[model samples]
Target: MTADMLIFFIFVLSIFLGFELISKVPSMLHTPLMSGTNAIHGIILLGGMLVLASAEGFIQHVAGFIAVVLGSANVFGGFMVTDRMLQMFKRKK
Candidate 1:
């Protein structure tokens, strides 16, 4: 009923929904999904920077830093994975 509890419930529900949805996706669609998620991660990275810019307290700053780092790592890792997947289809010279 409280705001924190509502957020927690929504977070838990999203985890379940996301897992169910991803588990059902065809393998052929994953490359496109990875690309899409990378774009979202880039947005997350931008959001983190904005959070860092607006942060007034040490805890907020630390949270923002972690968010930015993780978002950046996710974006780069997604790109690497997508590249490797694409490479699998290339013919050797």
Candidate 2:
């Protein structure tokens, strides 16, 4: 198989493994784990934004722009949800 196809297969396999592992976690751990993942997603969003800013040419620019938008949406939305969840645990003091 070609290198690209091999890489794609590995990516898919990793995603499948990730889901399987996550599924095995205790229910109470899900929120914390998801919060961490959202933080990582925010980092990805920043990277996407950087790429969009530095991209050259129309096609690359367009692709980068799309990536930035999608990533930013994920980052913002994830953080919002995480914040809301965390608030539930806050003390009233």
Candidate 3:
């Protein structure tokens, strides 16, 4: 298989693996997991920006831009979820 096909296959495998791992986590651990994943998303956003900066072709630029946008959304959404989870534990006024 070509390099692009191999990368696509790996991406698909990672999606399945991530889904299985997340599905097995207990609810009690989800908040902590979300925080961790937020950090990961930050890293992904940085990587995407770096890739976009170095991208040459129109397709690569578009793909890199999409990756950066999605990564940024994930990071922000994760933080929002984490904040909401923390709020649930705060004593009511």
Candidate 4:
């Protein structure tokens, strides 16, 4: 098989494993895990912004720009929800 095909197979396998693990996680672990995922999603937003800024062609630029905006909104919204969830667990002084 070609290198690209091999890589694709590996990627699919990894995704399957990831879903398997996610499905087995306890309910109580979901919040913390989601918070961590949101942080990673924020990094994705940054990468999307960089791509949008560096794109050359008009079509690519517009598409990348939309992706960046949507990604940023997702990151921000995720952080907001995660923050509120975390706050609920904090003890008052």
Give per-residue CA lDDT, model 2, range 1-93, as digits (tens): 999999999999989998887777778668867886876667777878888889999998999988988888788887788788867868877
lDDT, candidate 4, 7-68, per-residue tens: 99999998999788778777866887788677556767787888988999999899898888
Tell me model 4's lDDT, rounded to 2 decimals. 0.82
Between prediction 2 and prediction 4, the one with superior TM-score is: 4
Cα lDDT of model 1 by residue, 8-78, tens digit: 99999988997887787778777768775675556677888888889989999899899889878877777
The number of the candidate with the highest lDDT is 3
Pairs with backbone N, CA or C atoms under 3 Å apart (clashes), candidate 4: none
Tell me how far the alpha carbon of residue 80 in candidate 4 is from the true structure, in angstroms, after superposition. Answer: 1.2
Instruction: Please state the error at residue 29 of candidate 2 in Å.
Output: 3.8
Measured with C-alpha atoms, the lDDT of residue 31 in candidate 3 is: 71
Candidate 3, pairs of clashing residues: none
lDDT of each: 0.80, 0.82, 0.84, 0.82
**Where in model 3 is the C-alpha error above 4 Å?**
1-29, 35-39
**Poorly placed runs, candidate 4 (over 4 Å):** 1-26
TM-score of 1: 0.58
* Clash pairs for candidate 2: none
lDDT of 3: 0.84
**Candidate 1 residue runs with Cα over 4 Å from true position:** 1-32, 35-39
Q: Which ten residues in a row have the lowest lDDT in candidate 1?
A: 34-43
Per-candidate TM equals 0.58, 0.57, 0.59, 0.57
